[model samples]
Target chain A: MIAPGKLARLVATNALSNRRRLALHTFGLVVGIASFAFFLSLSMSVRSVFLEEIFPLDEVEVVAPRVGAADVDARDALNDDVVNEIRQHPDVKEAVPRMAMAFPASGAAMFMGQRMPFEAGGFADGVDPAYVADEDFADRFVDWEAEEHEREACGPPPERECGDHYYCDQRDNTCHKRVPIVVSRTLVELYNTQFAPSHGLPPIDEALEGMLASMLRLEIGLGETMFAAAMTGGESPPRQVEGMVVGISDKAMPIGVTVPIGYMERWNREFVGDEAAEVYSSIEVVLEGREAVAPFAGWVQDELDLSLADRQGERFATAIFIVTALFVMISLVIVTIAAINIAHSFFLQVSERKRELGVLRAIGGTRGDIRTLVLAEAALIGVIGGLLGVAAARVGAAAVDFAAHRWMPAFPFKPDSFFLFEWWIVAGGIACAVVFAVLGGLFPAGRAANMPPAQALSQD
Target chain B: MAGDPIIRLRDVEKSYGPASAPARVLRGVSLEVGSGEFVALMGESGSGKSTLLNIVGALDVADRGHVEVAGVRYGEAKERALARLRNVDIGFVFQAFNLIEHLTCLDNVCLPASFSRGKSPAEVQERGKEVLGRVGLADVAGRKPGTLSGGQKQRVAIARALFQRPRILLCDEPTGNLDSHTGGEVIEFFRELNERDGVTLVIVTHEQRISSAAERIVSIRDGVIEDESAGAPAAKEAAST
Candidate 1:
């Protein structure tokens, strides 16, 4: 019948009377909770890197097997018909087909007074605009060649009647619009972390990256690269193409560049053949949710006779999940042992306070009151220990980050910190602490409540 | 003793230990004390005087026959109902002055009211302070029992017992732990409370000086009442005070 507020106050007062013992018990609980929080956060961070940066799991890329590699069929090839078929599936949100440049190509760019050149023979691919439609720079990533009905002519090669965001093509002696291209965020990270430092260039940070669309431009040689020059014969004269960086995306190719598919069809037809323009290299199928991934991937392989380009994301996800669960179980075992210690401590406390409990009974306290008092004390300990545990985990994460920065070697896609402390994880850790502590206190509280008042009073 | 008695017992019997070899502590003893009366139960160490007090206060159950206090029968009562009966209708003062050592004296005094329903903390606290003031230990309310003298601790215990204003205050050798001078002072406090507030008192003791202040004395021998008699002349003088 005691008021809840007063009962809480009474519990606080009783717990405060034994500060040293409570602190010692709480230390054990904090260690368990800290280990749980740290392991969970670390797993989440690692999983994020794999799922978001290295291999985006929500979208699966299905590639047709090479001719004669499998039981080959004409229908098994990835083209517009197959793309439309995959797009209409119940679980498939969208299916975007991609065409790789069938001919040799290479590119060079000058940035911050440094000329960086790279070969892109089989790396460049043309992606459907729907793939990057969600990006912030989607409006700029369109086929400029298709938009221009007729080429505009002017005086000379370098000086032409080109419009805004357009340039002159010296090969055709006409004003040709610059093609918009996108590169993967992973490429930029690699440049900033590994390539820039080795080449003595200023690393591109977020501020410089924002200016990349206007500041960096590349001259792509469509044919007759260094590799193509080594061929026997049947090579065309190289034509110069200009492209401007539009935006970075996870959907872009990791090692090369991605332009709108319209440019690919035109260039492939002009350089290779009409067959090369019609046949797509791959199709990226985006599902509505992760729950549809397994079934959709199975359908892609079985019904469509296509293979997923990468299942490493899902495999890595599963592996990270299992490791996280193992760590959490170990943490739970630690917490359970701490709870057992708490029970032993409470038992000792109840034994010591037997006469006081009897006096409370003599003064009209019910058995339920005694039980609640003990449990409330346990909950208080849990809250204190849980909060301290969260703090300790945060400190440990910072220390690890500091040490990693000082001692670890630079690598591609290295995260800023290895821990991701989300609100739910911290709250869940505290709730677990409370639940474990209450479970530990149950038997001791019951024993205290069930003691006979007269016999307890008779104790010395 | 007039009107219906506040406490009634009929042929109560009690024993302890295993059923194979029981140690009988009370045997077919019946007694009653009227409302607002002062009575003392006198007995030897193993004569069951304390056991009888415990049974009457709802702290123990009688093994046989009926026991009733403040119109509630103990035979058919549940533990919860018995607890309520003990909380509302009876108070106990112990020989050890058993205050919870962790709490302030005021908190100890408010213990009974803390367990009762429908009273806010402020109301209970105000009443606790008033009871401590009544027992002349108001200034020591913030002090722990460990900081108080034996007489002061007993006063705090008495204040806690009176917090609920129970109709019957049961005392089991309340002055047993105090020196003679302090014991006399506590006995005088009980006499004043009984006379001024019309609170019924059932005190268990073997000390003759403590028994002399009661209006009636019942002596027990070998787990049964041997005789009953009037108190000494000090009872009349005590009543006048």
Candidate 2:
């Protein structure tokens, strides 16, 4: 039967009288919340990096064969006939046969001006020339002529079929004349310095754009060619070949020259020597649809009786493991310390307010009422702390991005690339703050509720 | 008009500590107070006067006894029911002026009433102000107890006791912390309340001066009543004198 107004006034008075202690308690909770938010954001960001960036490009489903388990002979591993059979399956939209070989090369001429160790290899993939005509894939790897036409409508009308070097306007459009080899921006910039005058190409500026116009020049052994001379034996027969640079792609290139499937088959027959050229160290296949890459890669491995190993997927897994362990342990320690601090603060608050609580009880407040009042105060603290933590995390994230861009310009922190402020992170942060605050308040609130009114009233 | 007793105790006993080493504060004590009677309980410290007063006020339960106040038996009553009885049937005025210091005089007076009964805040305020005015504290109604003088605090306590219109009022040394002049004024307020409102008043104190104000005085020692006497003014003219 207590009047609402009186009860509210009493609660308000008690809270105001001990404002300093309560504020201290709230501060401790804020720190805990901020730490929890940081850890939560970190965990989510790592997961997003794996799923969005690494997983899509690397293809997670193709399992590699266990090491040293009856290694298949190179001749029997992944033949062109087997690859063609996989492509015939209805679910398989596209299949590319690949061959890889690694050789030693000088890395000194790269753009960074320092000779870094380089592994040179030969890569060949047999693809349907029509696959490059896809509008979506073209956006990622090649700038479509249609898009260029759309951008400049009033400019010079596109020339009709400029031979094998460009797309010809015909009833059946195919990019078969000379497929553009995409190279990394790093390679393009480095090669521009060496061959700019001969090609009459524009000065390479942007890394991604530079990759578009660079070509590879290879020297095979007929007798005494540069590559043959550099080999262990002296005075080998020389063979020189020049490849037209059709298109430069922004994708990171494997440390090797990429040739068309037609060129690879011809070169393998002529120069690689029968026993060495027959075995491929590895192969990379890009499926038609991004979603189909995993299943198709799996199918290819099964058909060839060969295994696929994705270095990117393994790297991502290692990154997740290291990051999770480090952050989770740090967060656990921070939150535990904060919880203890909050508990001590609340204990002191209750002890100091014994008389106030006694007065409330004497004035007809039940034990339930006292407990509710204490819990409400704790909840309020948690809410404020949670908001502060979120704000701090956002500010910290911005500072981190800025610092990264300034310090590591080559690998600038890409804001859009990382997951930030995901829904689950926010929800979990708030829940953690509240739960911690409650845990801190439990013992103190219980003691306050059970205090003898007579003794409490008698206390000074 | 004479009526049934408002408070009754039969063989009430209260002990402290464990059974082997228990110290009995009250042993086989019995007493009664009629409706509208004003009685003063006089005893030295530790003579069980305060314990008896507490038992009568329903603030504590006797270890072995039948204690009844306003027709409710204390021993069998539930905790909530006892609280209800304390809230509505009995009003207490403590010796040390146990006014909630955070509250204004009017709010302090009205708290028990607000808790025990259903009344709008505005109504409670109006009633509280009226009671304060009755105790000659209308001007200080907004002042908290901390700022008020001792006598003023006691007046606020009395006002709070009267606001609920209880059947019995228990005062444990209501003027103990005040000066002689302030204490006399407080006693007068209590006397005025007893005479004008027909409220039963039970005062526990060792002060001889306060006994003069009561209609009857009972003295106790060693946990038992030693003597009982009518007040001087009533004794000579009464048949029981």
So what's the TM-score on candidate 1?
0.93
Candidate 1 ranges beyond 4 A from true positions: A67-70, A73-76, A148-171, A226-235, A402-411, B1-3, B233-241
For model 1 the local lDDT of residue A205 reads 75
- TM-score, chain A only, candidate 1, equals 0.92
| Candidate 2 per-residue C-alpha lDDT over A1-460 given as tens digits, one digit per residue, 9 for 90 to 100 | 4445555565566556556765776666566666666766766676666545445443322233544236644444555555566557655545454444322222212222322233333332222234445422342333232232322112113633344234332323333233334344445545555445454544555443534333222222222234534542443233433233444433334234444444444444444445434444443454455556556656656565555565465566667767866775676566666667777887887887777666556545566666766765666566666777767777776776677667743331133423367876677767777777777778888888888555565524
Interface RMSD for all numbered candidates: 1.5, 3.0
Can you write out model 1's per-residue Cα lDDT over A313-364, one digit (the tens) per residue?
8889889999999999998888888899888988998898888877777777
The candidates' DockQ values read 0.65, 0.33
Instruction: Score residue A106 of candidate 2 by CA lDDT.
Output: 28
User: Top model by DockQ, which number?
Assistant: 1
For candidate 2, the docking band is: acceptable
| Ten contiguous residues minimizing lDDT sum, candidate 1 chain B | B230-239
Instruction: Report fnat for all candidates as fractions from 0 to 1.
Output: 0.67, 0.26
